[model samples]
Target: MSDTRPTPIRPRPRNDARVVTEAAELGTVLGIWAHPDDEAFLSAGLMAAARDAGNRVVCVTATLGEHGTDDPRHWPPERLAAVRGHEVAASLAALGVSEHHILGITDGTCAEQPPDGVVRRLARIVSDVAPDTIVTFGPDGFTGHEDHQTVSRWATAARATAAPRARLLYATTTAEFAGWWEPTRHTFPVFLTDELPLRTPRSALAVELSLDDARLDRKMVALRAQATQITGLIAALGEERAREWWSSETFVAAEYAESRSSWATWQVAA
Candidate 1:
């Protein structure tokens, strides 16, 4: 479903204080994702925005994306983990995110067993950081990946026990409508706003960040720093096309519990 019609663009509001205050400025933000580049896609803008506001941002990726890609001649599983790990570190550095950790979970194997230990590991991180906010995939795991769902489960359980006061949010996607970039059919409306019904929790608060080409380029550069996967494709696409692919970061706050009396960025239950 594409909108072929042209529409006028309205300017975004310019209340600096309002914008600053409205953006959730949590004391610490812990982003738990299923794979290496998952956080780079969904949370980079928010993380950059958070860091700009002086908040600590930590990322705990569940796996190294060792199962990514099909180039047998290029990347075997044994090499993929270390290569992607370095790429993750580089990407994090580019995005100004300092705290990065990986859980060493086997990629594509999250569904084969119970996740008690995963839950414990997540809880331990929660206990240590005690983040004011915890961000991860929604129950549908964004793309319904078992690893993502398992990670979400473990994150929520950890939030419940170790950091009851921490607000929980989910990173989501525009996947269903992410198909409008067909170069031959690149109508602006259809290409940009043919959004899908975001499949995260219905009550999740939607957050959108609009960026200029420069900011988008910065983000793409951060993403491109992950040479293990995106490098070849991004180089093929060129910067403008790459920017189209990387612009307008979106998210949803799936489980933020407002604390009773605090004016915190994310209100966590006591």
Candidate 2:
């Protein structure tokens, strides 16, 4: 499977500390993820900030999240997929993102598809979007789900093949947050803590964005829109703890051809 992964056209060292604080430097930003609510949980604040800063924001979800139902007995896979799709749209809307693409891959089975097919599909979107920065899950997938891992690989490969010059960023959480959330993992019907690949070391983090009150408020709205997924999250972490956990977004610079100084201009609102 490693043989099928697309090698970076211009590989460079992963840790580049230069922070991005300006939207102009970021230009158009694209976020790719495996499931519907992923953007909301992982990068909604960042997306909203970019959009508010007048940068074009686009999102691509690889699956409808059919398997994410906490009440499968009532929702089932098909019904849950439909619901999640609508939820994702509303969430993105709250973040001021109107452009999005759905790949329609089967839920919980993204890794089963041929790697080439996934790469091709994402590559086409990247080519069309032509974004300055591309964001997606890192190798750990943040949750350690096979689908998440698969999407991470596909997105990275797509960037390599179709948008080598674009700056690639991976959504991640700090080790401290992982520790705080670890004990509460079992509260969720899905995505157990033990199963999740949480926590990117602080050393690997290249950029950290702290959301302001208004941005955090918007993030909460986007998160609440995914009622099905958030019911347990809110109950487990409580509103305040959950907010604390989500207040900051972190990323590791994966690949880029631009100079560190140019990337440093992109900023996240503090």
Window of ten residues with lowest summed lDDT in model 1: 261-270
lDDT by residue (40-64, candidate 1, tens digit) is 7777777776776788899999888
Q: With candidate 1 superimposed using the best TM-score fit, by how many Å does residue 225's alpha carbon deviate from the native?
A: 1.2
Choose the strongest candidate by lDDT.
2
Off by over 4 Å in 1: 1-24, 174-204, 212-214, 235-238, 255-270
* lDDT score, candidate 2, position 47: 91
lDDT of 2 by residue, 1-270 (tens): 123332322323455446664444667999999888888888888898999989999999998988775567898888888888888899999999999999998887786799998899889999999999998887656665777767888998999999999989887666687777677666542343342434555555656788889999999999988888887668867888889988888877875311121111111111
lDDT of 2 at 66: 81
